[model samples]
Target: MKKPASAVPAKKRSFMEFMKRREGQRGLVIVLFMAIPLLLLAVFTYIPFLKMVQFSFFDMKYIGDRTFVGLQNYIDVFKRDDIFGALFVSVYYMGGAVVQLALALFFASLMVFKVKGDAFFKGAMFFPYLICGIAVGFIFKFFYARGFVLDSLLQLLGMEMEDIPMWLQDQRINNISLAATSVWRYTGQNMILFLGAMMSVDSDLYEAASLDGANKWHQFRYIILPSIKSIVVLNLILSISGSLSAFEPPYVITNGTMGTGTYFVIMNRLAHENQKVGLACAMAIVLLAIIILCTVAQKLFFKYVFDDGTADESKAAVRRRKMEEKAAKKAAKSGAMAQSSVSGKGGQK
Candidate 1:
């Protein structure tokens, strides 16, 4: 049986129509599957964000009557300079974050060297990351107390109290001590992240470099670093965010005091002492904005500066070539049609 002429065009649907029909059904199924979680996220996460913004505007009195004071709550913290302590504490935490990331990267690189007991060592390194933040805070507090008390062996070596700074008490030394503990605790996790990235690098690159008379340092600088450049940005963003919002370590160590710990950071100051919820929220939002800006800046910087230059430029050149080819094809098709029309007219005559 011959099919109707109208059915031929209907059967040959446009590519866009085919895609829309296929994707529409698939998208409906995906949306259905995702709907419950989306609803939960909207209710929990987005609702809280809206509430925080709402609270940023008002100062509620203990009495039932609520008065909207506009941006006064935000302004008051700056006017009093009480927020400076929070900023200080945040910077203190950031110091720890840097130390942690550096040590983690270093140790992770060592693991990638295929040392003996690699699995055991990697596990040991990552063990601390599994611990609760509050627990880490308490454990380190004890370590700080025993600072120079381990002088039995040190005494034999003629080392004394002068060698160990009063870690918990003296404000100047305390923050640094906190940073040291943080590095010790967090380095393992970072090591794992870096090690995984390092593993993905092509082994042939190392072999080629070795054959070219490149030393360990030369290979690391030229090949290893370039390959893991993306990981650096990832770790940097994580480190920066962790440092900025740091709350647990300083809060637990200082027991909410002013002088000796990361209580100087805004999270501690706002939560424990000043109770400036509005100011704290403002500080948090500002910190979040800074982190986002820095992340974007890092991404842009890495894409341009640290990228495998040849790959990006080659892809761009390829795209240009394809565009030129397409244009040439279209022009050739038009010329062929014109020639065919002229021939047809001569035959008709």
Candidate 2:
């Protein structure tokens, strides 16, 4: 008996055939294009991250003989109040990130309307982001120095130098002042991102909404927000992670002193200053896990509420299905009636 068609195995392509096809050729070229980046990503990014994870489980310094002490480093990380305290500083940074994104969105919305001198305004706003992190640190240090630029500016505004609080030395608001520097630097960058996402939204939708007598707020809530949801979520994740990894401003300006020590700053101090490499790695891993967890939670939340938590199927598809089912039932009913009528007529005759 001959084998059925379904029983036959598909022929595998030979190496020559794979190289000869246009698609295969293009894929080979694309693979080559991406090869260097993949290599660099693996070498620099993945390798180091893996090393950090490995180091977290062992008792080792940067230059000492390694000893396997599983989970002790992680335990040690949690035992220290100072480390926990430093991590708490990240809350200020996270708060700043929220305010930063808000300001960015507000400005982005304004710029989208294309006011006069928008080009100049956009450039001016974005200029701060272009400044180097170290440069911003140095600039803000001087700006915040006592009886310096900030105090002078306040004096010019009719506030006495004595009345103005010290920007960096004051423990009550030093972290906030540092966080403000970060906000100033990154808000414009975020605004540009929001602007780009907003611009990509279909203009026809906006016109249609306008025709429907929808005001700007209504259009933004209904159309703009939905369209830019992915970008906004992406920025939120970035902002959260950035806040957790904050270092430069506090590190450079305050040197992690005066209650301004952040998680990363404290980690740096441990790894380099105290030579607690394993403990630092453990802290890094813990922080990484926290960020990953938050990101995943946010993703799940956004996924669940996508499309206003309406029916899973598109409205058009749902309507079409209902129509088809109704038509089928109507046809079946008509057929049954006709058959019964014929049977009754035959019996009567």
Candidate 3:
């Protein structure tokens, strides 16, 4: 006797049939086309990284061929006394990143609150990000070159134009000016990211908190803070990486000078002045290690911060399932009522 149709392994057959279906076949072709660029990207990007690792083991010279140097280049960065000043400048650069990130978060919070003219405000805030870093550097350079603000302030204080402090001329003022320019350009991008993250948070949570007599500050502290914790971690990582790898702003403004330049950052020191390819690779590796450590620290920090928190993956899943179940029941009940009405009409007729 022949077996029933349902007893056959129809699932595997159906999957294979679906693969051959015309609609899915076009999607498969499109997917392959999209994947080609991704394959090229992985090869070009990761192959260079691997080559850099190999180069870091060799003593690269300005002239002729390179010799094997092992870890000597890395040792120089840590052990050299001359680099101490640059290291100090790296701390100052960190200060710049912190200022940029904090201001970005503050502005993002304001934008998330649905303030008046929010669209225009967001566009104005983010306009700087559209301009090139070099352009920003030169624009600020011109702004400082004018000496108008300084001269005016000095004049108000009963002093002449001669008494005004030159912005780019002095080392301390130059660093601060570079940092301010960097912040002006990059903070908008960060603010947009934070705003996007804030907008995704559950509105119901905010409502619940409000119902519990939580004010705006309390809601922010209890609800908004916990919801956007992941974004904060992400921004921290970006800020740290950007701080460690800072180059364009100082390079443009100060022309790579010692005190005035951001080339004090390890990556900058390795690339421009030192011209040590091996050491630069080693620096890249060190920076990579630092980033990893920071990510781990952030994970721990988030765990600690969220210790008293309410959000959980399993709880969210349960809530979603219950909502879906309720919707399904309501749909089934409506269908049953419609069918009953049709049967009653047929009997009456």
Q: What is the C-alpha RMSD of each candidate to the true structure, in Å?
A: 12.1, 13.5, 11.1
Q: Please, what is the whole-model Cα lDDT of each candidate in the order they appear? A: 0.67, 0.83, 0.69
Cα lDDT tens digits for candidate 2, 1-349:
4766432444555544544676777989999999999999999999989999999988888896999999998888788887888778889999999999999988887777648998888898899999988999999999999888998989999998778998998999999999999999999999999998777665666788789999888777766665556677788889999999999999889998999999998999999999888999999999999999989987888666653343335657646755765676577877775445433322321
The runs of at least 3 residues in candidate 2 whose Cα sits more than 4 Å from the true structure, single-residue gaps closed, are 1-35, 305-349
TM-score for all predictions?
0.73, 0.78, 0.70
Worst 10 residues of 2 by lDDT: 340-349
Q: What is residue 301's positional error in candidate 2, in angstroms?
A: 2.2
Clashes of 1: 6
Q: Write the per-residue lDDT of candidate 1 for residues 103-162, one digit (tens) a residue.
A: 776776666565899989888878988899789988877767744333344556787757
| Superposition-based RMSD of candidate 2 using all C-alpha atoms, in angstroms | 13.5
For candidate 3, lDDT tens digit of each residue in 1-349? 4765442566887756765786787998899998988888878988878877887787774556898988887787677654445555556567877888888878887776659989898899899999987898788766677456545666788987766667777776666777777788888888898888777665666677788898888766655665566677777777776766677777777765747544335456665566777777766766567678877886787555552354444555545744665676577877775445333322221
lDDT-wise, the better of 1 and 3 is 3
Q: Name the best candidate (by lDDT).
A: 2
Candidate 1 is scored at a TM of 0.73
Rank ordering of all candidates by TM-score, starting from the highest: 2, 1, 3
